[model samples]
Target: MPDNFNFEAAPFDTLSEYERNLLRSALSVGYYVPGETLIEPGSTTLALYIVLKGVVEERGKDDQLFAHYGPDDLFDVRGLFAGQTRHAYRAVEESIVYELNAKMFHELCERNAPFASYFQASLAAKRQLARRDGQNLAEFILTRIAREHLLPAVEVSADLSLGEAARTQLEVGADALLVRLEGGFEGLGIVTRTDLMAAHFQRRLSDDTPVGTLAHQPLAVVELGDFLFDAMILMTRQRIERVVVRQGSQPVGLLHLTQVLSLFSTHSHVLALRIARAETLDELQRAAETLDTLIATLEGNGIRLRFIMQLVSALNEQLLARVFEQSVPAAFRSRCCLVVMGSEGRGEQLLKTDQDNALIHADDISSEDALTWMAHFNEALKGFGYPQCPGGVMASNALWCKSVSEWRHELQTAAQEGRPEQLLRLSILMDAYPVAGNEHWFSSIQAQLSTWSDQGERWLSDMALAALQFDTPLTLFGGLKTSGERLDIKRGGLFPIVHGARILALRKGLMVRGTLARLQVLGKHGVLDQHMADNLAETFELFVQLRLSQQLAGDRSGLRQGLDVSRLSRAERDLLRFSLHVVKKFKQTLGRQFHLDTR
Candidate 1:
């Protein structure tokens, strides 16, 4: 038995002697020291390193110290099968580490079901972190107790003023600079040339303003040791043009938009432009398909799933807007509104889920021709890859293709006295995003929805409660039960979290599409407490990661690419269980938050 003891004993401790013997035969010495590079980021590291003594500090080249590894913590196991190169492993002090390569590690786990069981939560947690688009590398590492490459970044204070920052940018010719704290980029911020220009155009700040004053809080960051591919995805997803690269929390270098893009498509900007200018239906379809290819390429290159979804959604929005411009008649077009509902609304359109949409035209007399033209445009989307929604919520459905007066009336009526079935079916409509047409129509809808009264809340609460009713697949043993077979990860696991969040957010009068986003809005307003919100959001992100992973798998296998209920790991089951608990709390919270319990 090892002398080092875990405060929370892992399942490994429960293995039978024979199982331990099977595991022990291939075991390398359990070892590690502090302040050493245990597994450098970017190398192919396929092994489990057991720490025998000394704490290993997980430091990114950016100088960000994330997690501290203690005895018995498993390191690099994800890398063993992740197919991605090792990331961020320079120890903080002298340490000894036992490295078990893939084959031996597999045998040991195969020999001990308990040891393999221990892996479920670890894998689920890592994959969830990986799929979160904008979480800093430090945040990512802290959770793993495991993994940076330093990137180029500039150090600036958060107290700096926009104008002062602008002067520094002009002098240095830097498009952006990173705000820094003594420990690292934790408090670091980025100031871009555009930010400077915007500062110049907008009034109300002095020249002597501190350079740090203009720093946007939590300026997104990249560690020096991170893969360029990861950095590129973050830049795109967060819509930032540059990232501060740091070494061990020190701003060592700066990575620009150009450098980040080099790792993505040959030129996303060029493709975006081409998509914007494409005129005909055939050209738009081709552009949309090209977007799929771009996403597939990005996915293949190990770009994070959240980032892929962001780019695909952005590309789609641009393409559809162009199509709207081309198809809608010019005169009435200015008064109409086109929107995307459902997953696209949440910015979570992984692998082309069906289109959930509706259109709003002007209140005044409209031509049947215009409606007909709109119907034709909806058909065009099918060729472009958005399947006609099975529920018939698209603009082509006469019930949904209404004038502004009709839409406002419908929403008000729904709020005042809509049927539960209607609310359930039309929840997506409430989250509609205006891709094109009348901006005013969107604003009107948004305002009315936000001001929804007690009656509205009741409808929303019931809808939310209904949505939250999905039983989390967690068993009484806190385990996920499958048919002793692979489970449909989506049905059993993800949809519960997502749909629950959706109903609650709506009940709270929130319009944000992403669950993470909805939680942010709701949490701020006291609808969800901080811990519950964080857990709910994390659970949803976990669901997205798993569901998307399966979709990618099915894509590779040439399957239909719908949600798969099976094929989850044990760790994922744990996460899903955690998520269900989160939902239970949410359901309880929803009852309280909306006065359902009191009622």
Candidate 2:
């Protein structure tokens, strides 16, 4: 292997040592200058080319650039397999590429199933393969209950005396004991340490009392194949310490919150605990400072990007809620609803960006009073690291902090006017998630908005069209167009996937918030085929991962929204190009579905 080459890159990464040796033995080098054509259209495939330095452009029959290959990037694999070239490869910059004979490449592919799959699989399949490759790094969180060792269940007959049940639990060193039902109930019930202590302290039962009288159904339960994270989420949501682990109809064991927490000591649970315990702004500020460190820790531990995004989002919501709780007066807080919009609303925010928030005050509350508290709330967030919204979309703005009736009127006006910008604002509001105060208020607004969207075809079409405003960074011939050294992954790839899904959800009357959840719901309802939904989900995740990697690497200097492609590894670049292609297909589908092309 060359000094610059790493195992994480493409076909080489999937190859066995023997196959890699075969590849290494057959390697040869070729160099080309800018505009020099390496393979002309309709030419026979002679070799597989892997760029060692500089850039290669693949141009289509129309002489339009479609794709670009940079250092450690591979090209011409499909052409080699087809035994002819469909497009021309030209040097975009002075470039050096390593060549391996097509015959040897064929032999290697024939010998290695994974190596062949890496080249021939769909983008979604490739992404799954990549995930599996790093499975060990993230397995503690993603692993299924069936894979982990479950604590043995300690069961006592419902008729057993409390003394006997307590002795059994103590003897078994179990934190909880199961009461097996005999006649009345069909399922077993669980009794925990707290339950036993509460019963004893309240003098509600005697030691001779039947255990059945004290037993109740478990707070939560998970099946054998369910991921640990699901169980953790349940425990977190319910404020419970453990959940019953079951296999089929039989009880397997218990999954304790402590077990999951022990595995992820640096998880969001710490932030959540801090938020819940914080009574003052100073303490919350101290807690907020740990967020960047938490993100860095989780990313370094190789947690899946989506899960990391969710964790960060959950933490952010807690931070915001705490700030709202501290900064807003109690009298006003109960009458108002605080919502987070944009990426934060969708639970896809991976970094602390601008504050996209609004307040929905009760009809009786004055807008002046709401704005005063909202200003304090917004300033508090700024002190905690969230910058003010550039477009003045924060709750502090008088226009945003409005009475319920006022917000309803604003939505009606925006939908009725049908201006492109107004529709765009309406789309942002569509993603709103209530983080603090009265959630019912926000839900009522959402219900109204859903009804309005159902009748607003022009509004939906305009929103969908906004997703296509930015041309995909990759040209028709597969070459990536860059703005200086930066490419805006957000606009080029993320927006189309997000807004397209949002539009689809609107038309279907689906109320889900996250992009992936919307796609899943759409797929479940047969609005989107499962394969296409999975492909889009994976593609969106890839774009998020790339942007996150860029942010985490401290590369946010010029063009804050752009990702510098030159800094990525060969495998990452390949995945990025494939992901971008997926985005292009997604946008084309959206345009056709929404009649954007005709408009």
For residues 1-599, what per-residue lDDT tens digits would candidate 1 score against the true structure? 33333322455555676755555555566344445466677777767776655666554557566455544455666677675443577555666665666787677677766566556444334444333333453233222111222232456676666666777777776667775543544666666676666666785567666656556767566665666656654664455566666557556666766654443344555567677667688877776776656655555555555556666777667777877877777886787888877778777776666777778777784647556867887788887877787778777778778877876787778877768766765576656788887778877877676666445766766675554455555554344445554444455555655666677666566767676687777778876677677777666666666656666666632234334444553334445555656666666665675566755
TM-score of each: 0.60, 0.86
The 10-residue segment with the lowest total lDDT in model 1:
141-150
Candidate 2 collision pairs: 65-477, 66-477, 66-478, 66-479, 67-477, 67-478, 67-479, 68-479
Model 2, runs deviating above 4 Å? 1-8, 30-44, 53-70, 88-96, 128-135, 152-165, 177-191, 198-218, 247-251, 328-336, 419-421, 475-477, 524-531, 555-559
lDDT of each: 0.63, 0.80
The top-ranked prediction according to TM-score is 2
Q: 2, model 2: CA deviation in Å?
A: 8.5
lDDT of 2 by residue, 331-369 (tens): 767788999999999998866788899999899987777
lDDT accuracy of residue 331 in candidate 2: 75
Worst 10 residues of 2 by lDDT: 128-137
TM-score of 1: 0.60
Model 1 local distance difference test score:
0.63
